[model samples]
Target: MATRCLRYGSLAFLVAQDTALVLLMRYSRSHATGEMYLASTAVCCMEVLKLCVCVGMLYAGEARGSISGLVNVFRREFLEKPSEVLRLAVPSFLYLLQNNLLYFALSNLRATPYKVTYNLKILTSALFSVTMLGQKLSKRKWLSLIALFVGVTVVQSDNHKSDSDAPHPETGLGYQTLGFLAVVAAAFTSGFCGVYQQKILQAGKTNMWVRNAQMGLTSVCLGVVSTIVKDRQAIQERGFFQGYTRLVWTVIIIQAVGGLNVAFILKYADNILKGFAAAFSTVASCVLEMAIMHFRPTATFLLGGALINVAAYCYNTPGRKDGNKLPR
Candidate 1:
């Protein structure tokens, strides 16, 4: 029913994002700053809109301490902690900045290599947890990290071999290289942001809806500021509005829905586990990229991706259960 629809809807959304990102990469030669800004603006607008809707649903008729039975337990509790509510804002702002940089990188690069490099976020987050938050990891985590590195290397090698043969006139290897580096940096920053967010959640007990509303507002504000600074008159011009038809607007809205799916996943799970799930979008993107280019996936690439997925799963899983711990 609703769960099934959402599940399939999320899968389809990933496929569409992969397709749109690939198209954006292909159009990098003719990419205008205003167009990029507008597309991202659309995403930000929908994010906030949906967040508002979710929050409204939670608070429709409930009075203080009425126990209206919302889906998330944390939202009700969060209403009581005004200080903690304000504290969550910084991490939300950080996520906005990180995602904007990530979109810029995706706009410049192809799918496969970008995804492989993005896996480093797990390592970055784990290290940050250890150094910044004083969190300890089990030995199994160390092994999982090693496995993740090896798998990513293999995937990157395979991607290189495949992309080497593709013809490129305007956007060349240099742009792609820079994009890869940018995405890697974005991934690292995003990982740290997630760590901070988890801290806020553990401290404040904010529900998914409340946290999403805060984060969405932060992103919308950030996106508007960035759009203004980059192009002051860009918002006034009708070109940004009319550049695409209704179909394009629909696509952007769908991407916003995908973003909500991601936000929901992040709310309840460990950030590292959520990062691993985010890799599914990368795989979907790679598949679409290969299909659009008429290049069937090579055995090496598929196998490498599978191995990477396995490592991501292992690294993301909890190290210990109630009675027993996973092997190191």
Candidate 2:
């Protein structure tokens, strides 16, 4: 458990750092005409780094003869049971959608309101769990959900300051309202993906390594295809070697390491838990951002963040039904 906690803590740290760097760098490039191309290249670099890290982690697991012991688990299990492969891949694809869409939305908005509105994800995730996964939610979980709503409301109120006075985009009510909905949609899809991923993981004595390796391959293929479809020239222009600075490349590498741990956690645990992890990781990132802002956090911001953390913890507690059901 100590190791697990440490691992998660480190993952959170990396995600927080990566997000901060991405947001800040994107902000610097916001006025540039090639924003989309820049963003795509940046995202691709991060994905490639993630692919490498996943491979390394899989190898490490194989060396320990644990989760990756079945290096040939693909041939033995998936080749013989193609349906199983499809089952896992299906949820992972959905997860990929949820992730990319969320990032897209985030890139479009500034970090403050984005942070405040993102908490709505927890509510959507629970709804997806209850409706699609047929998972039961304890009364405590419901209360926590309510707390999350209130916390988000408070944070939103804090985020309403005039953007004219600020350096970044002011995030008006209309944009935030729309961003809120987009984030909600992303969260719902992500919640469903989580429940389904848990189902796939629990289906049989499957080798987690092979499952991840295939997922890495799938992500690279699908990501490359999608990126090409969106802007082929943009991708090629931002050659792998020329697209990023040394510091940015370092950030991408660290983000990949963090992402690998997150993927492993996803394989073994519930998806709602992963959502909570992401949400809390956002909070951690927000705190880090606040510190970087070099201004004192208002009482409202601090209290609201605390509430968000509480809600996340309540949702993450063991034996608490995450409100998702799996096929028995």
Q: Tell me, what's the RMSD of every candidate?
A: 6.3, 5.6
User: What TM-score goes with each of the models?
Assistant: 0.70, 0.71
Per-residue lDDT of candidate 1, residues 199-280 (tens digit) = 6655555456666666665566766776667545665775445345454455555556656665543444456655665666
Cα lDDT of model 1 overall?
0.60
Relative to the true structure, candidate 1 reaches a TM of: 0.70
Error of 2 at 151 (Å): 2.9
Backbone collision tally, model 2: 2
Model 2: ten consecutive residues of lowest lDDT: 164-173
What is the model-wide C-alpha lDDT for candidate 2? 0.59
